[model samples]
Target: MSDWLSDQAGYVWLIIAALLAICELLIPGVYLTFIALGAAATGILALVFPELGAIGQFISFAAWSTVAVVVGKRWYGANPVPSADPDLNNRAARMIGQSVTVVEPISGGTGRVRVGDGEWPAEGPDLAAGDKARIVAVRGGVVVVEAVKAIEADLPDQPRDDQTQSKG
Candidate 1:
């Protein structure tokens, strides 16, 4: 068995590498990729030095696998491929940084806000109806907001005794 393994170490390593590569595809964590690289390196080394024994080839494979894992972690960890839209799974989380209107008065940091046609529960500083607010963050089903501007307060004064403005 030892003689056969010593003779076929290179071919065995190559096959192991191919299997690892397939496993990496089946489970996509990019972890098996490093071991696959190591196996390929060992296969090449065995092909170059066919006189090396099976035990020596196994030792070389272990060393190569360790180095590959460390290097792969550093290179891939430092620069990862970011998703195009990270918050695509959560619609509420994606709504941060948007301007919304205070649909109901905010008191004790809880109220309702309107973003486009939808209304949502919000928590933030106290604000009256018609106040412009900005969505800062989302907490579970509620959004955290801050008063941006009081649109009605910023408007110019108008006459209150107009005929069309009388209440029934």
Candidate 2:
């Protein structure tokens, strides 16, 4: 068994490396890339230094793999794209200052508001579902609203008209 294992040439290790690299393609992420690089190094070492024993080949593979992973991680870490909020695609962002109707009674800091065609979680003063509220702020995809007094149609339209009528 020892002889069979020792008899295995470096090319076999190199081939294993190539297979690992190909496999990395099917699996996304930085892990596979390191393994592939390690394998390629092993193949090169085997092709050039065929006399290296199995233990030596293994050590080389391990050392190269470790270096690859560390370097790849650092290189990737140095340049990271800012992650975008998944909820930014919603249409609520456009309703920042729009008036919305409360869909559910809000007590303390949580409630629901209907803006245009969509309903969103709201945070603000206590208000009933039928009350009208103006969106004051938006954070973490939650809308903040303040209750608005319902205007009565019976109120006079102009202050000047009331004064003139009183004078007459």
Candidate 3:
């Protein structure tokens, strides 16, 4: 058994590479795939250089693995995969620009506002309970808000009524 392994060391390396590739498939992350690339490169090296023994093959594998990881990092950094739903995990972030009702009077720039089916801590100008507000931002799980009346006040002017008179 030992003599057979010694004679077919290149095939052993190829088998190791195949196993690593299978593991990469089982795991979705690209980390295992990079390592698999290193193993595959080592197997190719062993096949091309039969005189390179176990020690040399190990050194080659290590060098290739390091290179693979560095290149993978750079490649992933340069072209990040965009998420289908950027706010999928961040519930608070999704609340931005959404309207909320004041569940408690917001005094001293702090209170609670009802957003969707739940209430969230709010920070904004003073507002009495029952007033409406819009979520402007989210800070540390708190929703920063602006009064609806204030937002409407910032809109362009309405039509003039100089020519209008009360019906007689």
Candidate 4:
């Protein structure tokens, strides 16, 4: 048994690498693949130097695996994957720069504004009903708004005196 184990040193590392790769699939931290790479590297080294001592192999595996995990973490972290919805977590950020109507009068910079089907608490200068305000920012679950100039309605030509007179 001892002689067989000694003759199959390279196989031991290859098996270790295969096991680690499997473990990586079960794990969530995304760390085991680096160790598996190091183990595979050590296995290749063992195949190259059949006369190398077991202690030397163990030390090489330890050092290589540690470096692989550390360096891999650093390199992977340097580049981040761009998410599809980066603002998904920040609900208030989506409301910034939108326009909302004041459903309730704003007194002392506090009021309620209607945006779509939802009414959100707002903070801004005093505004009355039907006032138009532009969302500027969000603070403490409240939408901050600034006054926006209201667009004037288009008017046609003035009617004549007879047209303005009441019908009999």
Candidate number with greatest TM-score = 3
For residue 120, give model 4's deviation from the true position in Å. 4.0
**Who is ahead in TM-score, 2 or 4?**
4
Candidate models: Cα lDDT each: 0.91, 0.81, 0.89, 0.89
Could you estimate the TM-score for every candidate? 0.68, 0.58, 0.80, 0.71
TM-score of 4: 0.71
Specify the highest-lDDT model's number: 1
Error of 3 at 48 (Å): 1.2
lDDT of 1 by residue, 25-135 (tens): 999699999999999999999989998777888899999999999999999889998999998898988899999999999988899999889999999999999889999
Q: Which of candidates 1 and 3 is the stronger one according to TM-score?
A: 3
Worst 10 residues of 3 by lDDT: 150-159
lDDT of 3 by residue, 49-107 (tens): 88888899899989998999999999999999999999999988899999999999999
Winner on TM-score between 1 and 2 is: 1
- Shift of residue 163 alpha carbon in model 2, Å: 24
- Give me the displacement of residue 105 in model 3, in angstroms: 1.9
Model 4 C-alpha lDDT per residue in residues 1-168, reported as the tens digit of each score: 987886788889989999999999998977899999889888888888987679988988998899998999898899777889988998788888888899999999899999879999999999997899999999888899999986888889899999999999
